[model samples]
Target: MAKTRTDLINQVLDRLNILVYGQSPSLEDVQRADRIVDGAIAKLASLDIYYVQDPGQAGPSGGAIEDEAFLPLADYIASFHLLADARTQALAQIAEAELRTIAAPARTLRTLRVDPALTPRRYGYYRGGI
Candidate 1:
């Protein structure tokens, strides 16, 4: 998983075959590639991840979390998937599902995940003795 913007950019570029290992990129190619990466990152930054980010920053304000790194991985992967399909101008069903998951993750491990504070009690069911 990518921990930084540079890492994320490199991974996407590699996936797109825009850059290959054992070869240096030309300045023009680098600039063009970086533009695409920046576009994807900007799209990703619009997600509702639990992080403090500056007005203009593309990532967390205080930097990304190391222990809970899956958040960033999901963001980068979703962004890359979007970029790869830019020509289509529409995301695949799988990409849409991934983006949805990133935006609102489900708590499916438990059979019932509800907020006790928000749950209303039935007054009729209450009793003074057991």
Candidate 2:
């Protein structure tokens, strides 16, 4: 018999926690992910250097939009390898609300970021720090 969604989530979270000591979440697990992503966002502050191919050359052109894109780009970069979107940061919160009625919840969720431009498909993920 095929396993339910609940079974699948349990499996994924279990697998994820191998590095995390097997899935019974601690402040440390969630805190670490949060810190890592925050650092990723901070790293993006220097991304202008990446676009600057030549020492004195101009960068990707788009007028006002280029300057405007920084925050969203930073957000997108941070989320490339992150878990949970900005919308629903806490699985526990979802459990208390949405999942309370349902028997199972989804764990293998897409990374979360705000600003529509930050959506994974828009900026393209770099996997490990571009």
Candidate 3:
């Protein structure tokens, strides 16, 4: 089963050590974390780590990211936003690296060749083949 946005937020709170067993985070905190999660998702999309074109499409009510492995990236990003400490920053960086590793397989590279015959030249004075 895929993890929901709430689950991601809870994970972030856990990482920050704020939502303990006997305590609950406030609504404001949860909302703030939700926004942070949205930002994190946007960042991932921007980096081509996550394929979703629009980050808002994966909101709390909307469908969640099916790949559970990427959840940690979102959690770390949200946690870092909630608490900008050295440890959180390190964790976020590591998560980004891990995400890149996970996403590497899905990415592809292609090279295109240009034919000299088709090239447009305003004189072609700089062509010297050695």
Model 3, range 33-124, lDDT digits (tens) per residue? Answer: 77777667777878787553323333345445456454556645654473668877777777777777766675356677899899787664
User: lDDT of model 3 at residue 125?
Assistant: 75
Model 1 per-residue lDDT tens digits across residues 6-98:
444444455555677976656565455555544544555665433323222343122332324333443344344435555322333344455
Which runs of model 1 end up more than 4 angstroms from their true locations? Answer: 45-93, 108-130
> What's the TM for model 1?
0.43
Error of 3 at 105 (Å): 1.6
| 91 Cα displacement, candidate 3 (Å) | 0.6
| TM-score of candidate 3 against the unseen true structure | 0.65
Q: RMSD in angstroms, all models?
A: 9.1, 25.3, 9.8
Candidate 2 matches the true fold with a TM-score of: 0.21
Q: How many pairs in model 3 have backbone atoms within 3 A of each other, for residues 3 or more apart or on separate chains, i.e. clashes?
A: 0
What is candidate 2's lDDT per residue for 72-126, written digit by digit as tens? 3323333333464554334323323332233234677888669967656756667
Please give the lDDT score for candidate 3.
0.65
Pairs with backbone N, CA or C atoms under 3 Å apart (clashes), candidate 2: 84-112, 85-112
Model 2, residue 48: C-alpha shift (Å): 3.2
Ranking by TM-score: 3, 1, 2
